[model samples]
Target chain A: MNGDAYWLGVASGFVVVGVVIEMVRRRYLRGRFALVWILLGVGAILLALFPRLLERAATALGVTVPLNLLLFLGSIAMLIMIMQLSAEAGRLRERTRVLAEEVALLRTLVGSADEPRARSIAAEDRDQDSPR
Target chain B: MGTRGRGKVLVVVPAYNEAEAIAGVVASVTRAVPTADILVVDDGSCDATSAVARAAGARVATLPFNLGVGGAMRTGFRHAKREGYSAVVQVDGDGQHDPAFIPQLLAALEHHDVAVGARFAGTGDYVVRGPRRWAMRGLASGMSALMTTRLDDATSGFRACGPRAISVYAQHYPAEYLGDTLETLVIARKSGLTVTQVPVAMRHRNTGRPSHGSARSSVELLRAGCVVMLGLVREWPVIADSSP
Candidate 1:
């Protein structure tokens, strides 16, 4: 039963690593972000391949259950990932604001002149039509 | 007259859905400072604000979408910098900020890197009341303590930036709501720019709804206060002194 669980964990780790690799290859994931996923995948594989390492670390850390220790560490890692993503989101927001501002300014430069010229032409036409 | 020897001054008016008042605002600025170049940054207004400003003899930089006031002003600053403007003056398109005070702001810039047009400096007819007034006073005092400068109106958008400020803001203006006033000051001070305020009168908006109506004024006050506090903790890059 232990052997089966160990093999299942190894398989899941490999699957996660494989998906991340595929995503990187397809340009769906950036390298900086892929580093986190790859590290998580490798850590999972190492822990699965050597169950004793997890048990020993859990015991040393005063965690009564190895599984609980694993869950706690995973939660911490996820929390860190959440923080990193939040920072990235803020940077993206700033970039988006800059892009939006640039687009607005560029649009005005490109299309704003035509409207005023049309208005002036209409004004000239009115002037010609007037009694004066 | 002090602005005579300086380079061209670009008046940057950021407008968002301010069609009714934009034309009059542009015309007023033109009447006040005939030589100063007026650039109305239309922040993706769904109204005829861009057309109206353009017709009023003001250059229009129409954003593709609504980027709020902060984004709009940044665009104007970038334009001013690129066009080699030596100074940039910000005026609200809502007509609340009188263009008659543009010269005063420009004159103040001769002695300081940034000149803020303060409405509460015992010169303006405008009066602040209610919870929003309390919040403004708190923020003003807080920022004054933080920067070691007596800032009468920290939230005032009627401001002028010299060449140094224009470049600094062009590169790194805050993109947050109400950032043009509060965060920009923090940034200017952080970069070692001298900031001062000039007394300027303000008029009430002639048309359209004010950006922060009474219903949302308190909420906006809270948000602005939070942003100012966050600025205190945020790390800022130390820019080398480049004032001329």
Candidate 2:
């Protein structure tokens, strides 16, 4: 947009890259997931350094407004990242449910062993279970 | 696996905050299926559900936190699998499902691997109206088409599972809302388990009111529809005849 704006964009891009690197160094963000943000930060720095590149690319794609193209691409990137997060959450939920089930079942086995009737029933079950 | 002939049965009652009704439910189930073992899974209730179920002379498996009916039922199925039970019949801890109908359910297992206790199969006076009824009808029709057999009440919680059904459920039961009823049926049908429906009347709850209402029913049904759709397209495990 202007010289001051270009410098601001470049500085902000560097800030983003520095924060991501720091998070990765502190083990707060995984390297695999941080790679996307690192690339985005580098792309922002390059675009700020050469503003004509974005306008040219937008024009080649038949977009009259370069900023609109940037916004559109940004939205798609956000949606993709959000979808990945949701999928990861679903996997974690499934694993947690399975762990809860296993813990409950294990507790039952140990709890039943303390009672006499359950002991006899469990023994009978073990005897009958050999065929399977 | 065809019948209850020489096969041990386990009644899995999944309870969440049903301390007031768990005892009576356990007692009735025991009276109805005296020969069968009873396992009441307390789904992390804040009340005395686990203690009450344990006091009722039924074995209790207590989850560390709430996992809904599907999770508790899966826990029960895993226990049955490990303990060598040949069949499992699920009775709701709310006392809505009549335990006396359990024999009829087990009898249906003679030909099918899974038997559902249908409320609208021309026997029960249970009625539903408005959006809830429409949603249930849509699900029933969709499931009927998928299973290639009539399923009058696809959302019925009362059900019986043979050895094959037990094995399939122990591995892939969904913990999502309505997954215990609708998704489990889809999984069973997808896994090659023959499913049948038996007419049974539901009783009124002994303690609390039903969970959802007219306003929430529609939203929950929409989510449930997505669950059934996922169940349809999801890759299911093959269920081999495990009973020799």
**lDDT against the true structure, each candidate:** 0.82, 0.86
> Model 2 over residues A1-132: C-alpha lDDT tens digits?
878999999999999999999998998989668999899989989988889999999999999999999999999999999999999999998998899788777777678556456434444543564343
The residue ranges of model 2 lying beyond 4 angstroms of the native Cα positions read A112-132, B1-7, B127-142, B214-225, B241-244
Query: Lowest-scoring 10 consecutive residues by lDDT in candidate 2 chain A?
Result: A118-127
- Candidate 1 retains true contacts at a fraction of 0.77
Candidate 1 interface RMS: 8.8
Over the stretch B183-236, how does candidate 1's per-residue lDDT look in tens digits?
A: 888888887788998988889888875566555666877887777776656766
Give the lowest summed-lDDT range of ten residues in model 1 chain A: A118-127
Residue B125 lDDT, candidate 2, scale 0-100: 85
Candidate 1 - CAPRI tier?
acceptable
- Superposed by TM-score, candidate 2 places the C-alpha of residue A89 at a distance from the truth, in angstroms, of 1.1
Candidate 2, after superposition: displacement of residue A116 in Å? Answer: 21
Model 2: per-residue lDDT, tens digit, B152-191?
A: 8998899999988988998988887788899999898888
Best by lDDT: 2
